[model samples]
Target: MTVPAAIQSTFDDLGTPLADVTFVVLDLETTGGSATECQITEVGAVKVRGGQQLGEFQTLVNPGEPIPAFISVLTGITNPMVATAPHIGSVMPAFLEFIGDAVLVAHNARFDITFLKVNCERLQLPWPGNVVLDTVHLARQLVTRDEAPNHKLSSLARVFSTRVTPDHRALHDAQATVDVLHGLIERVGNLGVHTLEELRSYTSRITPDQRRKRFLADSLPSAPGVYVFKDEHGEPLYIGTSIDIKRRVRNYFTASEQRTRMAEMVRLATSVTPIVCHTTLEAQVRELRLIAEHKPRYNRRSRHPERAMWLKLTAEVFPRLSIVRTVRDDGATYAGPFTSRSVAEQAVAAVHEVVPLRQCTGRLSSKGTGSACVLAEMGRCGAPCDGRQSPDDYAEIARRVARALDGDGHQVIDALGDRLRALAADQRFEDAAVVRDRMLALVRAAARAQRLTPLATSPEIIAAARTPAGGWEFTCVRYGRFAGATVCPPRSDPRGFIAALRESAEHVERPEAPVPAATHEETEKILRWMEQPGVRIVDIDGVWVCPVGGAAGAQESLDDTMTDRGDAVDFDDSTISRRRPGLRAI
Candidate 1:
């Protein structure tokens, strides 16, 4: 059995949520201080899953040496008690088998784990390489210093109301730790920490400034909305959104929100203002808009809508597709607000490969003619400027371009599909991947454009999504932008409630002509919500339907493009302390 360098296990990968993970909570009663000076006297462990005890292991180990009088008094494990007990060499292998492959947890885990590792080495026994967790650190993170007084097992046991109490004994201490671990896990759940990798890397070291700003979120609404953290002079420092605005804002002061720069921003934050919304969709839209408008220094994403490039057909007698930074009201066929200019270009190039459109960037007049470019010379373009093609002939070519870029984008998809196949057949997987990515971006953008293209003059629509909490969330969208939104409590007749919600909802106005990338993104978000199976439509002043064959394959392409995920979490040291500086074990 050859263990090649790259042929390793993938189970260590980062995102196994806490609830799904098995935990082995263990405790050791040792003879003395360090592993070099001490010997294990007893071992106790409880195997747990989702807060339920699956099994337990308990054993007494003979040190094969005299037990000190103080140790005998502390543990109540005298020479007579351990004289009949098996030695550690025999007990160690049994303990290892009992733990299995689950994550190992214990209070002050380093002290206990160190002894086990050293003993395993001396006994020539294989150690189960399980990731370790210290409940003392977990207590420090979940319980405030004043609440616990100290992160000792005893203090945590009292604070969390442990099922059992520790009294210088192995099994009792292990039982207490099991309860503490379960409680801390539930606390971290509120901070969006559902994954085991997240728990392992969790850090709660908020700067003094973040601690002081805790008062700012005290008055924030618990309902859905956007939140802005402002500086002393009233400048926006950071912006965020949540269904529970107060909970989301408060999480910034906890260990789970450990983005280093975020702590610094919170330190400078003077106030927090929440924009309460009727639904999660509205909250998301408002958050994107505020981040774009404020361009907060502390905010990294959703700030620059203008930077998103779109490949749009020009509104002219001789229309040629051009990559533009702005999405405007001018009547033109558009392909994408692609992630980058290169991607937009790839989409445009993909279009040219199938539908021959004029490749010249110049704005040509109906009457004037210019020298033909290389593409026209190569017969790849219509060559309207060279008089090789008449106005009507070029107009026909432009119409093909419009239909290909606008409708279901069958031509564009087919073109990219052909190129991808050619590249893959040639063993150019990298090239094929590039084409696949272009196709994905094209599909996403075309999906957006197709939704708006046919219904450019579509009427207003009111729809509702059944929230997870049994409430109903409603949205009013007109011409692809949100007009109004509302959330209603659970009701017997959803239609009547939605109608009333639509009537009283505050109108979320939008500019009619020019649309920003943020607006497009928000519109797509609303459409996605409306398309969900359980969501119901209450009213329609106009029309809103998934365009035939539009974005139908977009979801599939998204799945294909994002199929590969990064491997599980790896840490530099066994202790979470070394994983993050300024963070200490309890």
Candidate 2:
């Protein structure tokens, strides 16, 4: 191919680096559309130096599979034509050698790059280190033709009045791309965009690494979760969480303009880590727990203990629920360590409707001689003070009230439904109707609060894998729209995947339970109970204890001075350490 006079003079006038620089314009003809399924049938490159063609390289690659009929028609490359051709495995080394130390220029760069990358990955070849310049992106920036409809190679050829022969052939396409690049350099030069770096900036290929890093960073989870970064020291430098952990962490790493901060962090860091949770509810709980434990220097937000409001219920005989402001501590029967008083009140109200417990000011007398309180008059309370209800009956009611307060909606629904059915069977229609309404309301509320997803049903635990560009890409079925995405990581390791799976399963298995009111002594006992198998720490006998394990082991463990209330005995660091190693650090 010969350089036209007008284009040659324009290239010379532009004084761009291309004339003196070694450039390899390349193209590929593949057997099919999908990069994963298809194989490249032809590889071609045209080497240009000092605005003159130095040499051209072209080879037919045996695709190792049958070329699809449609592909054959599109590129005029038959299976038989490539039958005796050199395979990619045999041709790649020479190709790499020829294009050594030269900028790679291509049309629709990603398409060519995808095929190239796939080929390199398959052959276990390290992709050559060369700057990529996309002529398509360059033309888009240089050409100001508003009516040009498309920027296809054919359209670009027409715009530049350049001859494009043997359209789809690899060498022909490479030559065409070279002409397009020359035209863009001329046009951009006219606009005073003459520098090589300046021209390179117009196309995305100039900063592939930066773009890849930014892209992967953006795809990270924008939800409240944990993130960890480890240094070459093999020690963790940062352990933090965010309402949007992925975004927060990505912001730290991808702040390109803030080179000092990012460079320092990246230099100190060798690996990125993340732990995704099912809900923001769990995220907040986990974040607080991790921050208090790890004390990572970068975690400024969650380092401090959060102040929480609690409902203590102080006035009743069985147990009085009092509304109080406090940090999470081991003392009293606390309903919440709620983020806000309003939220605590809302939870209390929800519990109250299902389990009719007294919310009154009057105290219960030992003689049981007090007059009926206002709540008793309204039938909202069982008047235990006046002996209208037995202690055992009131105790049972308190248990129901406690369960409602615990926010175990599934249990509440079943219990309420049974009660409603019993009332209806007894011909108490009005009472049944009220109970039925309450049951329905609770069901609706639970449904709304639940995290229901198809992925949730899978036996395998799911973690939002971070992409190389820093974003979370996952399958989402929204209404009727379904999207399946391939989220590329900056790097991949089998061991990392295995470790992530194990961690995810552990998290899903051990979701945080809502903490209840308990004295310091009771909390210690509860902690002890949790160490036992199949023994969960729950609120029991107006205290937080392992209801199952405590009852089973309490008699055996208790000394003569220690009461059932868990108040007299104190637990030592050794005991706490044995129960929870993580807690011992705190």
The candidate maximizing TM-score is 1
Give me candidate 1's TM-score against the actual structure.
0.64
- Candidate 2 structure, TM-score to reference: 0.43
Tens digits of lDDT, candidate 1, 1-586: 9986885423432247677789999999888988988899999999998777899999888988888999989888888889989999889888888888899999999999999999999998877889999988877777987786898888988988987888878999999999889889887776656677657756667544555466676667667888999999999999888888887777786566879898888888889988988777888888887888889998887787668677788888888889987767789766655656766776676667666788777887676568888887677887778677788887877776676566555655666678888999999998777666556555656665655542244456676667787887777776666667766677566667667766775554444333421355566566566656666666666544444655545534444445444321221110111111111111
Whole-model lDDT per candidate: 0.73, 0.55
Candidate 1 local lDDT, residue 568: 19
Q: List residue ranges in candidate 1 displaced over 4 A.
A: 1-107, 110-204, 326-330, 365-368, 427-434, 452-457, 468-471, 491-496, 506-518, 547-586
* Candidate number of the best lDDT: 1
Residue 214, candidate 2: alpha-carbon lDDT: 34
Q: For candidate 2, lDDT tens digit of each residue in 218-328?
A: 345555567776667656566765767755664553322354544455556656667786433344445556665666665554454334455554424555555566523
